[model samples]
Target: MYDHTKQYRCTIIRGKSKKEMDDFLPVYAKVIDEICPCSESEFESLFNNAFIRFLPESDRIKKTMDNHRTEIAGKLFGMYYRADDGIVYESERTQKFLEDNDQPAFFKDICYKMQFPNGTQKVGTTVRQRVADGICIRPIAFVLKVLLIAKQANVFITKREIGYYILNSLDVLQGNASPYEVFEQIVKDQKDGTERTIIVPGKATSYNWQHIKEQLNYLELANLIRFTDDKRVVLNLNELQTIELFAADYDKKPEFDVYSYDLSSLDGRKVFQLDWDYYFSQISAVSDQFATSAEALLFDGTVKDEQKSEGKPKPAVNLTAFGDEGESIVYEYEKKRVSEFNTRLANKVLSLGRTKGIGYDIQSVIAEPGDMAEFVKYIEVKSTKRLTCPDMNDDLWVDTLNVTRNEWIAAQQHGKFYSIFRVYFTRDGIFMFVIANVAEKLNDGRMTAVPMTYRVDFNKSSVDSVIVPQS
Candidate 1:
């Protein structure tokens, strides 16, 4: 019994001498290597036995072994394990199973950490147990499942389709741009005294206004609006207060970017670059510290890629049919700088893009005409090159533009609309461009688009501006 106890304790020596442990160290090192592949230093230290006394495994050690086994399994499968819950959490959509159709405290914390663009509050408790287990499947599998369910629920409608549906229902509405643009114009017109209106529901405005009245009633119950005793409508203070309160709520609806448009080829899948989700997970683990200091989280920086060439020119003899081909192409690539600020902005935008209610997928990064959109002072990121810049365009570059554009556009349309900045990097390696005067100079184009021009100044460390550029 004593011998068994010692073995369980992980003690190598039993009724033996130092020579036995020395001999056993090599074999023990190999076993440890198999169990904990990631922490090589720890494994080696434990295996080397160059120091430290021998001891047997205690109950704690046994439990640790079990944990190691689970971690290994999860890592191999690219899944998350909640040891406390004894379940694996994979992609954001998979979380519904654990939510129990209602938000649970632990799951709510995780939801905020994920910053799900839709901001699902809790896991659905009714999720199939098998799915909650670590199941090997593609990320889109969850989308297909949700879409199938949404089809039945009649909520599969895209935002784009909603505009026409609503327009048809309106008595008199004029919006020629995109659906989102139309929605913006409607809201704008209502606010700026260009138009006074109430949104009513029905296939046609002439039909019975019952649905519209019902919607108003719903809004009344939510305290977002008040209807006259006769059933007409106007915004209520309580509704505005509730909007402000829930706006502060740490949750929203959930959505995903299927990237269905970019799947033109098999290799494109490898280059499709939307792995910021994983990076968001990393940032969320440390969100509390950054949230306390919002300014510290602001990113106003740059990244540069340097190229190095090797060797002098080799003899290049190549003719139509006569001789040796050109010398072998030789060059190397390196990342010049990665600032913490750049990372913070990228992570914040990424987290914002993942949010539920304000989920927006960025489409492209362009230079801002000015730091104002719709008369609101907005954050903007500028690029050194415009879409028409010939020399600056390249498919092989590892710049931020390619990685973030689509996601940003998506976020703006769906979730937290993000802003971008583009500036020409000066020869002195500083970002010194400004966009103040130009925004105010342009009037009609703010809501639509504008021509972008960036000046190069190597002297400035940061930008300061007061003028509100339109468009």
Candidate 2:
């Protein structure tokens, strides 16, 4: 119960009766239109005006210079908007998702850190100090654990229960300790000759209950939990199935990053970049954290591919059945993604895997909302089959990838239109990491490319004529 590993806590920005997490998209869309085409340095000043302009006149006066106002902007923008090529814009189609399903966006993005642009220098203080000082906590983790805790009693949990048990007390959040074992452990509260004493949940001292109520309001707005008739919290029955998906992973830790987070802060554009990348890394874990219910991820036609051998003990993959199932999976996923824009474009998506020299494996299109119909996309698929599914924390689980000289050249040629869709074959499902504009990462000195193998050709005729022999 006293383990330091499980003692994580959250520090959500608080304001009275602020239920505005759902307003993220409309504000972002409006802010991007007002401030984009401006340099990355000009973002904050411009964002200040746009953000202030969006708030009600009465609220605007109080928040024009408020840090809470900017903090909320960081969280909202970090989740959905980003700065690319010196422009701030919305990356996720959360507005569309809500329009299609009548619900809020996913909660994972806001719960974790974000990635930066192709090139960013100094770090910023907004998100870094929060982590180093032990101020950062994933809100989703609390939502799940509190619901799980409440399941023990088949009743709603009040603010004091959460404040006493989870928010303040720490048995380290991950364990299977029975109710009796947990409450029984003590720190010798009264010892003339005593071994241990009880720590009552009722005598719970909740210092941060007011702040917790603020977060609960946001989580509730995200459709994460339900408020009972008396305004207490409980887990929705369907959320239990979603909770099952997280049986393996619930906490979004900040352990994995190829870059050095030892610095005090992060770059401005890089802040949004990191936020976007963090969100991308999460899609592989749960089918869809943004789903209205738990069953949104579908396995329509894809099946787990297994290797078969004919009484042999030499190799692992059955050579007779050696095939590009991963590529097939990627091709289908890309097609489905494009179909959201237009069926005609999705039908036009082609598998160019058979043609080796082209570098890219598939051809597709990318479309921004309220923009042009579509732009041709060049996609290179790099795939690996993991024998055991690896953890996708803040770090890149599938870190290194093999890129042919030809593929690198293709990435250089197509630039923004090019993407490397990293496809991972696991027993659970096919997971992917969409890396766009590889050339920019190379040019900006953000990503490195190392030469591993060399190719050479020889001609006998040329050797005899052009070469001189030494005795």
Tens digit per residue, CA lDDT, model 2, 63-139: 55344334444443332344446554433443333222222234433332222111111235434543344432333
- Each model's TM-score? 0.16, 0.43
Which tens-of-lDDT digit does each residue in 141-251 have in candidate 1?
A: 122222223333333222222222232222111111233333444344445755333233554542333323322222222222232343222332212222233223312
Tell me, by lDDT, which candidate is best: 2
Off by over 4 Å in 1: 1-242, 245-263, 267-471
Candidate 1 positional error at 274, Å: 8.2
Query: How much lDDT does each candidate structure score?
Result: 0.25, 0.47
Choose the strongest candidate by TM-score.
2
